[model samples]
Target: MKKILVLGAGYVAQPLVNYLLKNTQFELVVADVHLEQAERVSGNRARTQAVSLDIRENEKLEQLIEQTDLAISLLPYTLHLQIAKACIKFRTPLITASYVTPEIRKLDTEAKEAGIVILKEMGLDPGIDHMSAMQVIDKIKADGGKISSFKSYCGGLAAPEANTNPWRYKFSWSPKGVLLAAQNGAKFFDKNQIVDVENDRMWEQTWPLQVDKFNLEAYPNRDSLPYISRYKLEGIETLVRCTLRFPGWVKTMAALREIGFFDSESQKSAEKLSRDKLLRQLLHIPNGTGLRQIFKERAGQFWTEEIEERFDWLGLFENTPENRHNENTSAIDFLVSLMIEKMSFAKNERDMVVLHHDFIYEKAGIRHNWLSSLIEYGRPDGTSAMARTVAYPAAIAARFILEGTINLSGVQIPVLPQIYNPVLQELTNQGIHFSDINKKI
Candidate 1:
């Protein structure tokens, strides 16, 4: 059996751990800073250990890589370089959820030389969204049509009923990372002309979107135009990449931005606090067992008084003299955290992964429109939508790699037809399929 090692244990990590343990033929080993979390998720079915990945020690990393056939990093995007180096050193295949940063892209040449595979963007957006959208884009192109533009969007959200907080969000995953990402407001892109939305300008933009049965809102999360070359779209003129959000979320986010939630111009105060105190101040949100009791007159269950109180005591949301009214994390981070709590899948209520794709193409001198999307709501705690959506693609990709169905190596992605078509086809066979809707020109 193939030996697989997974790093980091978070909302995304749990699903990956559970899936590998129960389904695949691989012997799983999970390493986290927190040993209890690793054990809690893996039980005795898989190997669970505790290790600090904070400071990179090349030899130790190589040993782990030497031990496992594959290493799936559920860690931060920033940690990719170290992980990538370790993978290359041990000639082990690798995968991660981070966007392929330029530094990472540079490793492509080295990874290829090493004859090892490194797969990035294997999570939800970069994971399922990329492959799913490409599948449709390629299919439409083959039908003999001139593509006008492409806009793709995806979001991890909480169930509707659970959205009852001031921010309508929660901390399903890493709150600090979420807090840090918002400062990446603008990017340089080559869509038509040079496009730039820097600093606070990022919060100023909003786009409207609709995919079959759902109404949605979106905002550009990162660079979009570069994908034209990556996706091999030669003549595509207009394209935009966006992040999805519930209604009214944008305005509230904008207000938070206007108030300095997006500001990372200063962090001296934050640097002065002890780690525990700093985290406490940063996560000090008001929370309670009973929204009616703790919040009583506060907001909703999205974050009851007890929850806020914990956050306050813990230093997440509430304002306190101890907090010192300083910005410990980014507003977008806080917002994403807030959304996680609000949107997380529950024991009974199901969680869904929705990927909406809209394509416009011209054929026979006629312009036409086609809107396609895939909606996969997860089973529950035992089998979540997040897990299924995330795990399916990786599991499918791994099988293809192991079975020799997919043969190219190097720093790779899900842009190829062989990878997506069969993989998506398999997902469809398992009740994960995208729908196509066509309208007159």
Candidate 2:
């Protein structure tokens, strides 16, 4: 069995460590900045070793790599370039959950020269979403269909019963990354045109969608146009979109935007306040302050009443007594900490991932619609859909590398049938499957 070393001990890392510890023959070594986390996952397994170290230390990483064959990184996205550099230098294959960074992309030839596989974007959005969308596109094209427009929306949400919070959002995953994406607007293709924006411009045309009695308002999330080129839809003029939201989410998000929660720019008082302090100040804005108060105090007001209502309904406004010292903080800052506060799953409340995709295409002058939705609930073992969607695809990619299923070396994203078929099937078998229904376009 090949020896694999995994870096990081966060949510994604835990599921991965658990998966490898049980299923694979690979000798796994788990490393983390938090020794207890590494220890918790490693236990007493003979093939597993847990340790604390500054991974940026080149000499130490080199020492660990002496006995390691495959390096799996679950580190934050920014660390990918440095990790990729190390993998290339060591002639070791590395797989990460991050999107392909420009620096890492530039190393394709060097990695290929070193005979090392550097796979990226194999996690949730860039991972499963890419593979699944490609598979669907391939099927549509193969079936004599001309692609028209495509939209994919996936969100890791707290189940209704478990979602006591107003935003219906919780940080079962990374908080910083979540904030970054939410701050960044949705990008997509629409009206036979390619478009990208930070707001619910897609909700202007709401397609009523019903699945298992769950009604959702569809909107686009990121740059959906590139997928046309990436998925090889040359003959077709297509609009693509992806969204992340809860029911009636667009209006609430719009309210937030009206209140200014989407701003990534440094605030006017940021020079006097650190990021944390700025966040605290934002949270300190009272419930009834309204726009005049926001404009008077902060530079903007982008959040909505729904968010405030959610907070009030969730009892987030009440004094927990535990966090009582923070009376003057902003709701956003309080939310930041609150997310992490209950990020882990409760024993009875399940976490779920809802992934919805709509592909509009034409075949033989017939306009046809294909709608696919995937819903995966949290494991009884305390894993969230966020972790599963992110980690499983990554592990599958690693499996391909270990089993010699994907041998073309270089920096790459998983889009091929060889990469998608087995992983998708396995994921389906493991409670991740998409249901497709035909409709008139």
Candidate 3:
């Protein structure tokens, strides 16, 4: 029997593992640094086993790679290169949900030569977003329309009923990952000119966006210029990619940025301090001064009672020893810890994922506007919408590669028809499809 090796059994791994076990005949091994985490997902099922794996152990990783027909690295993006090297050495196919990096892209030639596919960006924003966008782009071009403008935005948040916090959001995935994304500089085309936004100014660039009846705000996501050629939108005007969040998030993030929550050097300086002291150090508040007044002065226009309440509720002002952990933890680390502890969903509460795309094209001298959107809600059974949207597409892609349905090799994403068409169809079958509308302008 063929074998499959899965690395990193985290929040999203269970859905992917369950999908594979139910749909395929492959023997499976779910490995993690924590054997219990791997075992929790593997469930002692037939042809499935759980094992401990510290990815740093190259020999064991290679041995497992050599034995499996394919390997899926659900490990953190930083660790994927090591796993990829092992897979390439053993001529084993590898898949990941993380975005493709330059180092990984450079391996295309080597991966192709090894006769194995190294698929990246197979998760939510990078995965479903690519597949869904390409489907529409391909169809519009096939119909002889020229795309003049395209914008896409995606977000994961607490479902309406579950949004009880002052921040109106909760962690469905990595809190640190979400915070790190805010530090990214972005570049995108607007009206035929490149608009560059530095990391510090990202939140300042947001504008309110209406997706169906849900009012939200959007700020540019990472670099979008490279995707013009990738999406065959060369010479296109007004192309942008954005990250969505509920209203008030942008202003709050801007305040956080101004207050030094995202500064590593400053965070290091504030290390070993209690939460309130850390906040004081970051804000330069004098001892015995009022936090509200000092914070409001520092936050300036971003200051609001609701934002203050959010920070207080997060325990940022707490002086208790309970708020301190790992004396060496930095301010950012403390904030992430607080978010993970205080912002996690309650029992029976669910999260939501939103993806929206808008397009403008011209065909036969007539202009048209196209809109495509997807809104997914998590199950009461504890399966998060983030997990489903992020893992399901990757699981499907893995099956296709193993079944020889996706014949091409080398570094790849899921933009091609052979990959996107069937995957989109299956997603719809799984009740996670989009709503699209086209009309003359």
Candidate 4:
């Protein structure tokens, strides 16, 4: 049997691991920094092995890549470049859920020459989002229609039944990733013009979105201008990709940003400060200041009852001894740590993944609108929706590569019909189908 080496057994790795073991004949080797975590995922399966791997050890990492027919990296995006180099050196196919950076893109010629595929962005937003959109876009083109506008939104959130928290969200994946994304400036196409939102104003600029009676908010995700060419939507007048969240999320995040909670700069004086002291310094309040007074002074008119309640629930204003701030923590890290403690999914709670795409096309002088939406929920205390939706596509792509269905050799994404169609069909068979609605406008 062919062998697949999975790097970094993280929160989202288990579903991919289980899918390969149950559905394929490939031998699976899961490697991570923590042996127990890797072993937990492996479960002593007949064709599976777990090993401790510190990716920094180049010799060991390269050796593992050399031994496997394919390498699937579940590591952080920053580490994917090194793994991609190893995969090239070993002449092994590679797949990852992370975005392809410029550095990784530079390896396309090398990977093409080696006749090995290095597929990137094979997970949730970049994965299903790209595949599902392309499926529609291609059909529209084939039907002699031209897409006039396209907008898409995706989110990982608490299921309706598990929506007890004020935030209406829980960490199904990395809390740090969610926090880091909040600080990104966004650019999207609207009315034949490029609209850019600065990082500080991202949260303040949101659109109200309604999905099947569930009211939510949408804010622009990362740069969407590049996708005009990436998806070949040259004549499209409007193109936007956004992230969905509950109604109050944007306001809460805006308040947090106003208070410098998302700042990444290091503060030397905060090294030995207590939680309360750190809060005082960060907010520019005196040490003896009351929490309410400090909030009033610092936030001015930006603070609302919802924001105040969220901060109070997170114990950000409390002098509790257990909330001891980390000595070396950056502002963003400190906020992420607090979010991890306050916003984690409970044992009995379920998470949800929502992906919705809107396509407006014109055919024979008539305008038509097509909407496709996917809503998947997780089993309580089992595989999360975020994990399943993110990992399953990668696993499906891996199987396809092994079966010689995907024979392309280069650094690529799932925008082509050959790549997206089969994966979308398989996703439907695996109970991750999107509901489509068509109408004339």
Candidate 5:
């Protein structure tokens, strides 16, 4: 029997673990730094073993990889390279939902020589987004269409019924990932011109958007210029990739960022500081002065009723007890902690994932405007939409690799037809599918 190792049994691992166990006969080893988490994911099921593993232990990681036919890394992107090296040494194929960073791409030749595939970006935004868009792009070209403009937006948000918080958001995946993404600058093509957005001005580029019946806003996600070649859309007049959030998110995030709340520097004295004290420090307010009063005076344009309400709702102005656990954590760490505490989904609360693509093309002298959109909701059984969408694609791809259905070796993503076609068909079978609508204008 083939052995498959799953590294990092975090929020999304449950779906991937469950899907593999249900669909394949492979013996699974679910490992994480936390024994409890690994055991929780494996569920003592037959053909599964749960083990605690600190991935930093190189020898131990190699020992595990050497025994497995394939290793699926769900670890943070920073750790992916370490995992990749181990897999290459063992001649074991590896798959991940993380983006293929330049450093990872550098492993392509080594991976090819080893005769093993290193597939990355097999998750929702990077995974399904790539597969779905490429499917449409390939179809358009085959139909003799000339692509003009392409815009894509994706987001994981609280379902309307579960949108109870003032933020209209909940953590279905990594909170730190969301915080880190806010620090990115973005670049994209607009009407044949390149537009660069600095990190500080990212929120300023947001625009309102409507997907299906829900209203949302979008801001550039990150450097999108590289995708012009990846998607084979050279010379396209416009190409933009963005992230979506409910109406007030951009304003709240911009205000917090401007207030030094997103600062990545660690504070040695943070262990003794409570939220109110930190708030006072950020706003330069004196002790005994009302936080609202000083905030209004110092915030200038950022001070708004809604922003203040969101801040107050987060308990940032409360004289709460200091968290001694903070130790040397940074301001952004505190923000992530607070969001996890305040914005996490409650039992039975559903989360939503939305991916929308807007395309303009010319075919036979007629211009066509097309939209491909997908909306998925978390199950009532407490399985999150984020987990399902992010995990299933990777899991399905892993199955194909195990079955020799995807035999190509080297660093890869799901953009190619062989990878996207079968994976997308299975995704539809799993009830995660996109709807495409087109019109002539």
Candidate 6:
């Protein structure tokens, strides 16, 4: 039997691990720094083993890769290159849900030369989003049509029934990732012109988006220009990929940033500081100034009752003992900590995943619009929608690679039809499908 090594057993790893184990006869090894977490995911399956592994320990990581026919990395994106290098050394196929960075792309020729495939961006947004969009774009092209505009948006959120928090959001993944994304600038094409949004102005660029019954907000996500080329949309008038959130999210995040919550430069010198003191320092409030007053003075017209209530709910004004410790944490870290404590999903609470894509194209001398959307919810007290959507595509891709259905070698993504068609079909079979609404304009 073939062997597969899965690195990093995080929240999203469970679905991928279970899917492979149930569907394939391969011997699977799940590795993590916390061996218990891996073991828990393994579930004492016959062909599965869980081991303690610090990916930073190069020898141990390489040894595991050498023994496996394929390696799936669920580790942080920063460590993917190291894992890729090891996979190359061992001539093992590699799969990851992370985006392909420049460094990772540089390995393409080498990976192809080694007769091994390095597939990246096989998760939710980059994974299903790409596959779903390409399926339509290619069909449009095949029908003698030209895409004029393409816009896509996605989000992980609290299901409507579970929306009990002020933020209308919950952490289905890393809290730090959510905070860090707010600090990212974005670039995309609009009417064939390049539009760049600076980090500070990212929130300001959002507009209301109506996805079915939900009134959400959309903000550009990272650089979308590269995707124009990636999607082969050479003369498109507009191309943008955006993140979706509740209506008030942009304004709240903007206020948080203005208050210096996203600042990573400031460090805590003291061993401990009360929440009020921490807030005062971060917001630059005077010794005698109250957080409420200072917030109004700095935020001016931007301050709202909703925003103040969010802060209050987070206990930013309270001297809670839990918020007293200073592990030399930065402003971002502190904010992330508060969010993790407040916004985490509770047992039996369901999370939702929303993916919507709009394709504007001209066919047979008539303009047409195609809107494709996928909305999935988690099973209460069971597998999360975020985990399933993110992990399922990668798991399906891994199965294809192992079964010789996907025979391409080199660094790649699930863009081409051969890669996307079967994957999309299988995803549909597994209850992860997109619905398309087309209209002539």
1 or 5, which is superior by TM-score? 5
> Worst 10-residue stretch by lDDT in candidate 5?
277-286
Q: Which stretches of candidate 4 lie over 4 Å from their true place?
A: 265-275, 282-284, 322-326
Structural similarity to truth (TM-score) of each candidate: 0.78, 0.84, 0.95, 0.96, 0.95, 0.97
Question: Residue-wise lDDT of candidate 3 within 134-157, one digit each (tens)?
Answer: 999999999999999999999998
Clashes of each: 38, 26, 0, 0, 0, 0
Q: What digit string (tens of lDDT, one per residue) describes model 4 on residues 117-192?
A: 9999999988999999999999989999999999999998889888887777889655888877777889999999
Candidate 6 lDDT over 1-441, as tens digits, reads 889999989898889988898765788999999999999989888999999999889999999999999999998999999999999999999999899999999999999999999999999988999999999999999999999999999999899988987777889666888888877899999998999999867767899988888889999999999998899999999999999999888778778777777878665546466677776666566689677787776665567999888888887778865444545667787788888888898888899999999999999899999999999999855899999998998888889999988889899998999899999999999998988899999
Identify the runs in model 2 with alpha carbons over 4 angstroms from their true place: 198-209, 248-307, 314-332, 339-345, 439-441
Tell me, by TM-score, which candidate is best. Answer: 6
Error of 2 at 44 (Å): 2.3
lDDT at residue 271 of model 5 (Cα atoms)? 51
How do the candidates rank by lDDT, highest first? 5, 6, 4, 3, 2, 1
Assess the local accuracy of residue 138 in candidate 5 as a C-alpha lDDT between 0 and 100.
Answer: 98
Deviation (Å) of 89 in candidate 2: 1.4
Off by over 4 Å in 5: 268-274, 281-289, 323-326
Give me candidate 5's TM-score against the actual structure.
Answer: 0.95
lDDT of 1 by residue, 1-441 (tens): 777777876556666666565545667777767767666656666444445444266676677789987888877788889889888878888878778888988898889888888888876678777887787777778988777777777775655655454444444445555545555564433355546787456546666676555566777767776787887776776677777766555554443444344444333253444434433333332333432233222323233344444344433434323332455464345445544554344566555566776667887888878777777775644566666777667766665666568776688888888777777787787688878886757
Q: Point out the higher-scoring one by TM-score: 2 or 3.
A: 3
Query: lDDT tens digits, residues 1-441, model 2?
Result: 788888887778877776776655777888888889888877758788898868778778777766688888988888778778888888989998787777889999999999998988888887888888889888988989888677677777777677766566666655656654555555565666655564445446445555555665565655666666777876555555555556656655455445555544432342444333444345445444543345334423334455556544544444333333424444444455665665545576778787877788989899998888888888776777778889888877776678788776898888888788888887887677888787875
What are the clashing pairs of model 6?
A: none
lDDT of 6: 0.88
